[model samples]
Target: MVTDQAGHPLFTTSRDRVHAEGLWHETFHCFVVNREQRIVLLQERATGKKDFPNCLDITAAGHLLAGETVADGVRELEEELGLVRTLDQLEHVGVFLEELTLPGFVDRERTQVFLTESNQAISDYHLQATEVKRLVAFSFDAFATLGDETTTEVVSIEGERFGRNRFVPHPPEYWAMVERSIGQSSM
Candidate 1:
């Protein structure tokens, strides 16, 4: 079942149908930052993804399957990045409504945003090859600038050079909200 603007259940529908019809559904977005709060993790989407293939995206995010609550969606972090974390370890940022219309898809998601701090090294992550390519960290400042298209800072991922174009095109406000959330949580 999908939800309305107030997050009330609207009706039952298949996931594919919901996307094709622009129905708002629930999703979970988690950002894993370093303990010192200097950087945030980004995951390169695997080339096989149907949408935004090979683009750098949130540390971990996924849709909530039918009947799944937001807390249950936390499993996506461990499933995609091998980072096991409990709900109590995550600080809820806020809910966001994201709307994007691609060539043949209309994605309207009500996202539950969360943040967690970790000092885990990239080498320790066991990536799910089909969903994530690799993980990289960007300084909070650099990421904010990139999101706003203020600078084309070169970022190295596994020895390969990448720039703003390689990252997903989230609105500047989204980046700002993320930064603010991180700041508030660690205070």
Candidate 2:
């Protein structure tokens, strides 16, 4: 389903057309934090994926299928990362306009962001092999400094070392907003 800039549902359409035509659609982004809230989870996208393959991205995220409400999107955590969580366990950060245009694709999403606290170890995650490769955690401070030259830490995922360049290149402002939200949530 397509939505207006204000995230009001307008009409239903196929997912392909939504991306191909840059139609606004609803998606969910969940960021997982450790018990102490000092670390945040990150997942590496599967290498075979079409867009942003093998890049480090949000802990777990997915599109809200047509007719799905924001709460329904919580299933993405279980579907993508094997973490089952109830709606009450999640804290809604806010809605965001996330738009990205590639040569052959345009992703225009009205993303409902959520945060959840978990102490689960990365090795314990049952990753969806087709969508997620492995999970990694970064210190909140270090992640907040992402995209800056001063930030230099290799992210190790299942014995593989990935540098900052391997991450999805979200704009600096996006990282800043996420950092602020996470910080506030931690307290």
lDDT per prediction? 0.83, 0.82
RMSD of each: 2.1, 2.4
Model 1: per-residue Cα lDDT over 44-142, one tens digit each = 999999788999999999988878888998999999999999888999999988887877788888989999888988889989999999898877766
- Ten contiguous residues with the weakest lDDT in model 2: 151-160
Top model by TM-score, which number? Answer: 1
- What's the lDDT of the predicted structure labeled candidate 2? 0.82
User: What TM-score, over all chains together, does every model reach?
Assistant: 0.90, 0.89
Could you give candidate 2's per-residue lDDT for residues 1-187 as a string of tens digits?
7999898889998888998999999999999988474888888899988778989989998888878998899998999888999888998888878788878788898888889998888888889999998888888766777746555555442345567778886666666677788888843
Give the clash count for each candidate.
0, 0
